[model samples]
Target: MTADSGILVLAGTPIGDVADAPPRLAVELASADVVAAEDTRRLRRLTQALGVQTSGRVVSYFEGNEAARTPELADALEAGSRVLLVTDAGMPSVSDPGYRLVAAAVERGVRVTAVPGPSAVLTALAVSGLPVDRFCFEGFLPRKAGERRSRLADVAAERRTLVYFEAPHRLDDTLAAMAEVFGAGRRAAVCRELTKTYEEVRRGGLGELAEWAAEGVRGEITVVVEGAPEQTVVLDAGEMVRRVRVREEAGERRKEAIAAVAAEAGLPKREVFDAVVAAKNAERSGA
Candidate 1:
């Protein structure tokens, strides 16, 4: 907070286009006392592209060495050095390496700031033609089929638009899983190679997208999925009790059945529980 205090700058790099780099990024890159990059080679290429030469020491700070390098960067910051962190693409710590350094710097009272620039998440959402008013960035899904499906199931009922980053090779499988879990009729958009040559955005139902990806998709991929539709059906107490009893009869525990029925009815779990309880009490009184 003081004039002499060191600062940690999390610089956002272009996802695909170098020209999109912010002007402050070049200044920070050249003047920082230390530059910690996810990939030194990619940093070199970026500096060359921006026509800027780093006046400070450059160190590799990637997933493989993030833990080991964070403290070193924190030390530099504590010593009144201006440290700049840049990932291979997008903002640092966004499915990239920079979170540890930021946390370390913050814990040490070192200032942390960012140079805002292009973001693939925002870019894809902007172009996806989906509702962006309320959205969440899921980052990436788990690679394993079961884990991935489980992850999808967690948000199967999310009403806010969802965004995700996925690798090229796994696009087909991911899309297929999404289709199976999110429903084939669910609308989605797959953005590939944003701001670069061969950039493409395919929009369709999950089923159609899965088929398209089955043929193979190349380049960086971002997927935007439409949220679950608003529940409109009004379930009376009797209906709620009936649904829970059906699930319970199908072998689900009472608690889980009530929760599932509540979720499907868009009602509080307590409401469904009360309904079931009332129904049982009424039946016993009639007996």
Candidate 2:
């Protein structure tokens, strides 16, 4: 907060259209003592588009060199230099670089501020036709098939709308995984090339989207999926046993089935296990 201590400004750039750049962004770009960008080439294009020239030292601060560069930026801040951090798009550090620099700045007791601008997550959610009342930004799914499926399974029962960023090439695989884990019938929207020419928002069930994506999709992609429908799960022992059996019939091991059912029903695994055991004993005795 002292005049001798510099401040870190996190500036948000356009996700697609260059004009979405905020007026304040230009001001910060022009006046910052140092400008850190995710991509120097992209930053040049942006500055040219905005008709503004950065007067300060501009350096790259991407994932590749973020760790090494953060301390340097922090040192500049401590020396009372105005540091502006801008990513390739959107705010720095949403799923991009800048988190490390921001943390370093904070740790050094430096002031931090931001120039809010366009966000793909918000833009996709607005047009996705899915419930946005409460939602979670999942960033991106794992690239590996098994890891991605496991990640999806972790949130299969999430009731809040889900949003994810994905590469065009991986769209089909990601959507297919979603269909398998979140259910083929689950509603979703695929927003592509947002805020740019040829922008498109495709809304449908996960299965349908997966099919469409299989044919090929291009450009930046954002997916918004409807949350799991609320279920009136009876907590009785009979209901618990029935749920476990259903999962077991679907080829899940008994232990996995019990754990999954317990998670879905918001009950302890031990409770579901006990119910299943009790039901099996009763059935055996009755037979």
Write model 2 residue lDDT over 218-259, tens digit each, in one string.
Answer: 999999999878865657888888888888899977876776
User: How many clashes in candidate 2?
Assistant: 0
Error of 2 at 27 (Å): 0.9
- lDDT tens digits by residue: candidate 1, 46-116: 99999999999999999999999888888889889999999999999999899898889889888999999
Model 1 worst lDDT run, 10 consecutive residues: 259-268
In angstroms, the error of model 1 at 6 is: 0.7
User: Residue 214 in candidate 2 has what lDDT?
Assistant: 100
- Candidate 1 collision pairs: none
> CA lDDT of each candidate?
0.89, 0.90
